[model samples]
Target: MKVSRLVALLIRRSPFRAMMLAALIAVCSVVFSLVSELSRVSTEGLDAAIFQDNGYLGTYSVSLAGVPLTIEDQFDVVDRAAESLDMSVWRYSEVLPEVESECPPFDQVGRRSLQVMWERPGVPAELDFGHIEGVNAEWCIDGQSIPKDALFAPSSDEEAIYGAQLYIDPAYANLVALSTTDPITYGFYVVSGREDDQVDALRFAVLDEVASLAEASGYAPSVVIGRVDSAEVNVRDAADGIALVYDLIRWGVLLLAGLALMTVQMLSARQRGWFQGLLIALGAGRARVVALVALDTAIVAVAGLVLAVITLGALSDPVASFAEQSLQVQARSLSATSLVPLGFGIASVAAIAAVGPALMVVRRDPLAVLEAPRD
Candidate 1:
């Protein structure tokens, strides 16, 4: 018989069995796909947050003595060293103390720390303050035209910005009484003790778009440099932990589903023993019988896969939300990239479950099968 006709006959004779097989496959596929997607989302979210907050995936700290390096000298050293390194330079800065006078009173400063952040002309506004401790400022690209109310100098001081985290010693925390809402400012004092001579302390900002020339310049000891790069290794490492748990759960579900599919296929094959025997009497080859059985399995598996894709798409939002809440990270959306494993999982389950019944019927003598009573 033609493949289409054979499939139709099988469906007509065992619609419920086919449905059960399909349901099993669909459930397994959905579970695996959801787990994979959730892992991707959680890992990516963590990676992004970490990179954004720190400006670099890795941090290099340099201890400064009481005499701080001049911001110009530090930048020159960093810029030169970054030029020769293999890594991408995103942002670089020196964490420095701001004069108490340049900032607001300790009580009003709240929990916010006052450290200068270096700014660039075309950096994204959202990323301009990507969770480094600081209040939002009306940023100006033109250094020369800063508003009078702006605490930062407009021209050569363009790179200066404040941090949100007010780093205070535990003993001084009560003195500052820094609440989350406090407005904080950081100022610098001039060597001559003239307030007007005060220059904003230098904090550095480097973009990943730049090459690491400074690191190669041999001035590594003069400053602390932080580097952020698009590294998926950390995210993948995080996902591996989650993936292990999901894999175990998926295997258990697959085992149960496989058993159900196997039982149904075997029973159906047994019940149609006479049919099998007659087919053997008709000179149907073993290969033909095997093909027929395999076809049936494929049909069920494909049905399940289709149903799963539909179900997952429909439930993506809820699945994403659950994953985000459980993982405590942003959830990722379903995409074509996640479908490959889903398809493989469903196919594997269907193929494995079909083997026992297919082999049993295929190997049986046609006359014996025909003589056997239907189950």
Candidate 2:
């Protein structure tokens, strides 16, 4: 059949009907697209919430030879572990041997007393710790636990002993000059920011690396990895529940949108029963008629998809703004990968919906179709 003839038939069938189908497709397409994007955003939000509410997940304590690993040692171990895992590892260490009385509380020194226990000595200068929060710092280890931005700056001449608190803590001035020639680091926590799916694998991998390091250092069976407490489990469960809700919503919306689109296409084809019969009676082959019906549906489907793409492009900024303000997640921009699902979904529904209508038109004899009531 010629393209011109197919178009004429479409025009005769009422452009409004085609327009309506296209509009439905466009709307459904956009709905699913937004749902997909929102799924990703909601996931990100959930991850953020989990990290905030479940601090235990990100922080792990380590002990070597029955002794709490020092921040200096922790850095070496974590650096090696990070290289092995090809991921980042954070340090949040507590200053060794809390001395509240001998050291005279940080407040007496006229400095803001941070209750930070972990002292990350010799942390990489280039490493950014901006994502971490709620690191409590103490007078003895004021600038170690906080993010890199508030990190203590030591002069080039003192860089060799910078991690030793040789200059930062006046209280530790004597310790640096006397019994402790090296930097003092006590108990610390190791943190890793990984996706939910990778948590278990990464945890085991880190433990393995820690164990390997322990064995090499002759501290075998003496290194202990921290376990998540009941409170941490509860928080993790809540975060998981939020993720489950998002999954249900995303799939539910897609399912409904698909059903609506299929129904519309079926009804549209069934409504054109008279026109189909007329074409057949006028000597149009059943194959030609079926092809035309399929082509018609395809045209509408394609138009709707294009319209949806245009509409989504125009609304991207507004949607992103709303997502940021209401959802508190950085909205991901649309990409070709993201559009793939939408395309496949629309195409699948259109093909399936067209099947029923095409079968109905093909099975009936032209004479019977013409004689039968329009209803």
Candidate 3:
């Protein structure tokens, strides 16, 4: 029989069977796409949130003489360690509180010591005050560089450290009668400088702010700040979890669908007993029958793949948006890696479904098939 005629006969006689095969392949493709895209988004977002919040891909902290060492000291220690380890130093720092300002009060406060503290409880008491530190541009996390504009300039040399005190909660702000205009400051007595200038200087600067400079030196934080890194890690981990679960579900659905498709194919071939017997008697080999079945399956699989691609493209925005809101993190677009797996999975399912029935038909004896009833 001609290949075209065989295809036409299969399609006309088994339209529902063909549809079932196509639907299964399409579903497989969609599942693959979703899992791939979700995983990529989760991993990338996780890395970003971790790095941003912790100031390093990974963080570790060390204690020195029971007087918790500053991030700068940690960096120095790590740098020395890296040298021994044959690694290059990127940046280093030790914590030192520099004055943030000695200028006209942003708000008129009559007292010299207002006793400001960080609104968030449990932050190191010493760091609670408006102490600032000098940092490299790359190390700065939150603020833009202090412009040459006078409004942001430090009034004295002591205040040259660039930093910002974490903002107080609104409830606390109300309690202190501190309007947004009030110049809230944290206070930290100057400790020994880290390979820098005078420790006795009482001056202050406006650009002082907190930052992470030690990660560049190959050290992580001892404790993450505000659970920033933890949150990101959790989000990505959740995505991976979802992917695993969905993969199992996809396989289960495919198994059921495959069985149904295989059954239909076998029944249809049995109904063509006379034709199959004629082909066998005329010297048609089992290999030829197998090849024909494979071709039919391949065609259905291709159609399913095409349909799956279209469906996923249509759902991309909604999926991304849902992920972003649900994960509470940024979701990146689907990647090439994601698409490859999905396409392969769909093709595999199609081939498996088609081959099962084809093999069963090949096993039947030609004379018996010819003598069998058409139904």
Candidate 4:
């Protein structure tokens, strides 16, 4: 008999059994999809820690050997070091005193309120500020409260602003003009290079430059440097624990599904023995009967996979919302690559499950099975 025809006969005769097998496979696929999505989210978080916001892999601090350096001098030295080493650097000031602004909270800022001076190579120093979105207030500068209207009122060149009050969204306050000449003993620096493999060599190069600059200034400064990834290693270790748990859940599901498939196939074979025996007696080869059983299993697996795809598509929004609220990361969508494991697992289970039933049918004597008294 043709494979398709045999598959149709099996389903037509045992629609409920076929449905149960398909349902099992569908549940397995959904569980696998969720595991894949969570794995992707954890990977994203790891990447964020590995490469910080400005793309730097390591942070270094600089200080003089029992001496103080002006902020401008420290900035120039680091800037020159970055240029010479072909690296990128970011400068952050210790959180400065927050000034009153009219900008709404969470508008130009994130969940927390902060004010800091931020500088990067090739960029001017600027104020970084965040505030509560709903609260409104006038610009208070140097203890002077000024209305927005008077602050922007027309003025002559002689009345030019020593400092101007900026009004903008809290999330986008980077363009605001700010500069300081305060002296400091140490400077903070975040560095990034093109190749990760050269990080250690690059660190040595940066330290050499710092020493050279200090020598040029007739003072040797103590350069302090540390790898940022040390702390991140702890985070990666935690992710590993989470990944182990995910694996346990995934494999547990696959094992149960495989056992269920095997049980169903074995029981169905016993129930349909007379029909298979009759088919063999009607001139169907033993191998053909076995192939038909395997094909029926394959068809059910395919139907279950199709149902799983539809279910995942319908649940995408809810999954994303859950990920965002609980995991604090966006959920990844289903990809062909992600489904590869599910397809392979289903194929493997079907092949293994079909074996026992096919053997039972092919090994039995067709004459005896057909001539036996009805049970």
Per-prediction TM-score, please?
A: 0.54, 0.58, 0.50, 0.53
User: What is the alpha-carbon RMSD of candidate 1 to the true structure?
Assistant: 12.7
Q: Kindly give the stretch of ten consecutive residues in candidate 1 with the minimal lDDT sum.
A: 190-199
Comparing 2 and 3 on TM-score, the stronger one: 2
Model 4: per-residue lDDT, tens digit, 29-107?
Answer: 7897888777767766765555542234444443334324555666666666666766555664433223444444323
Which is the better candidate, 1 or 2, if ranked by lDDT? 2
lDDT, candidate 4, at 183: 26
- The predictions' CA RMSDs to the true structure, in order, are 12.7, 8.7, 14.3, 11.1
Regions of model 3 farther than 4 Å from truth: 1-5, 35-243, 251-256, 317-337
- Tens-digit lDDT track for model 1 on 1-375? 775687689789878878877887888777777667655665566545544443234333322222234545444443543343422223333333232322323324433233333332223122222222244332221122212233322221121222333222222222333323343321221111111211112123222212244345433322222221223455545646776776777666766777778778787777766776677688877777767777887788889888988888888788668766887765544568777766666667777778888888767888766666655
Judging by lDDT against the true structure, name the best candidate: 4
**Highest-scoring model, TM-score:** 2
Local lDDT at 359 for model 4: 82
Worst 10 residues of 3 by lDDT: 202-211
Task: Single out the weakest 10-residue window by summed lDDT for candidate 4.
Answer: 154-163
Candidate 3, residues 274-342, lDDT tens digits: the string is 676767777887777766677777777787777877887788687778866887655533456666666
Give the clash total for candidate 2. Answer: 7
* Residue 232 in model 3: lDDT: 44
Overall lDDT per candidate, in order of appearance? 0.51, 0.57, 0.47, 0.61
Clash count per candidate: 41, 7, 28, 9
Better of 3 and 4 by lDDT: 4
